[model samples]
Target: MHTIFGAGGAVADQLLPILLHSQQKVRLVSRTAKAIPGVESVAADATNYTQTLQAIKGSSVVYLLLGLPYDIRIWRAQWPVIMTNVINACKETGARLIFFDNVYMYGKVNGWMTEETAFNPCSKKGEVRAAIANQLLQEIKAGNLQAMIARCADFYGPIGFKTSVPNLLVIQNLIKGKKAQWLGSADQPHSITYVPDAARALYLLANKPEAFGQTWHLPTASELITGRQFAKEAAAVMQKPDGVSAIPGWMLSLIGLFNRPLKELKEMNYQSDSPYLFSSDKFNKAFGFTPTSYSDGIKETCLWAMESGK
Candidate 1:
């Protein structure tokens, strides 16, 4: 049985169908009950030890895909507690764990980031991410738990329309026949992970016993493109006139004064302020998997935006 602890998240939502297609008995656990046909649903807040343990009971494998609110205070206060609760619960239940993570802990990298990159977090949020990730890594090193960290680069996909930066600023704008906005520098190349590929690679990693007790970067397209190039390609796919406006870091910071989300985004501007090249060659070679090309991914994303009216 496979249980997803933070069910209803973008990644967990994408992963559910894949697990079901493979004939796995699934349980969804979250703060609120989400009723999915034929799947067991448990309402539990992960920050509470008893609730977390009860929600994870009887699971053969557990996927920690929690996405907390994007606020520094919230992250700093809740992240560690949630990680501790989940780790202890999984340890007691003897369930193999898979943690879905992001690249924030690496901070600003001068080159392409591989699994071997050391944690040197820059932002308050990055520090919080680094701490929780290390909490899990220490257990792996001590051989106290069976687990692995599956990390991904900045993601863009059809489902996470609201939270995805590219979707909110670029794709959705292009779909609406308005000039798209690019955050940070438009010339700096950035690597983005496609949502479907992330889900597929995550499932593959969980099934492989050898993948446990280590960190693996999920499969992402090898090609790196600048924000300007991405907007151009997306415009071409949508057959819309190409035009994009770039949002500098200072401007984002200035706007953050009035908007809470933008204020939270101020610290993460480093990601788009310069090149963010991510390498997944380790997972690609290990699983013999390839990621979806940006051209195709953009086309599909554009189609989804049009169809869903998002």
Candidate 2:
């Protein structure tokens, strides 16, 4: 059976249908169970070793997709514990592991980032991410586990208003008839992953035994666009006004003094302030995958928002 540790987020929601269509027996584990047809739902806190072990038992492949809250204190306290619990559980259960990860561990990149890019974390959250990722990599390198890390850039999709920067600041704002906002520099080129593409890549990687013990940058469109271009295209797709205001770094830092989420984002402004290019040529060439373009992705995102009332 295929087991997912965190099952209610955007990627998990997208992954569920793919797993089911492939006729894979699926188990979903989270703090609270959500009733999903054709899948077994289990409630277990991953920070607790016993609970995590129970939830992951009897799984062929396990995905660690847990998303912690944005607070740094919570991340520092719980992330290591959770990683240890999950790692030990997967090891004992003999389940191959797939870890869904972000690019924060890379800090700022001068050009296109590949899987080989060194991890020099700039923020506290990035440090946390680097730690957990290293913990997994060390296990993989030591031949103690069969696993891989699937990493993605900032992503946006139908249902990730809270987690996706573009979805929250641009797409949803436009959908709600408000002026879209761009963080940092609107002129800097940015590469944002489409969530569905990420989910599809994960499924492909999980099924291939040779894909284990490596870091893969999930397939993202090769063509990069600036923040202004992204906002304009999203607005065009929604048939809304194309006016977006860029929130300067200083302004965001000031506002973050009161807003907890923005406060958490303050240190990561380096990403938006300059060109953030990501490359997925390894996965693209390996799997013959082509990612969805920005125009098509925005159109579908707009349609999904209107249809789902999100």
Q: Pick the candidate with the highest lDDT.
A: 2
Worst 10 residues of 1 by lDDT: 157-166
What is the alpha-carbon lDDT of model 2 when measured against the actual structure? Answer: 0.92
When superposed on Cα atoms, how far off is each prediction in RMSD?
A: 1.0, 0.9
Candidate 1 local lDDT, 133-161, one digit each (tens): 99999999999899999999988988757
Pairs of residues clashing in candidate 2: none
- CA deviation > 4 Å runs, candidate 1: none
lDDT for 211 (candidate 2): 99
Tens digit of lDDT per residue, candidate 2, span 1-310?
9999888988898898999999999999999999888899999999999999999999999988889989999999999999899889989989999999999999988999999999999999999999999999999999988999999998988866978889989988887889999999999999989999999999999999999999999988889798889989888888899977999878878998899888888899999999999999999999999999988888888888878777
**What lDDT does the true structure give each of the candidates?**
0.90, 0.92
The residue pairs in collision within model 1 are none
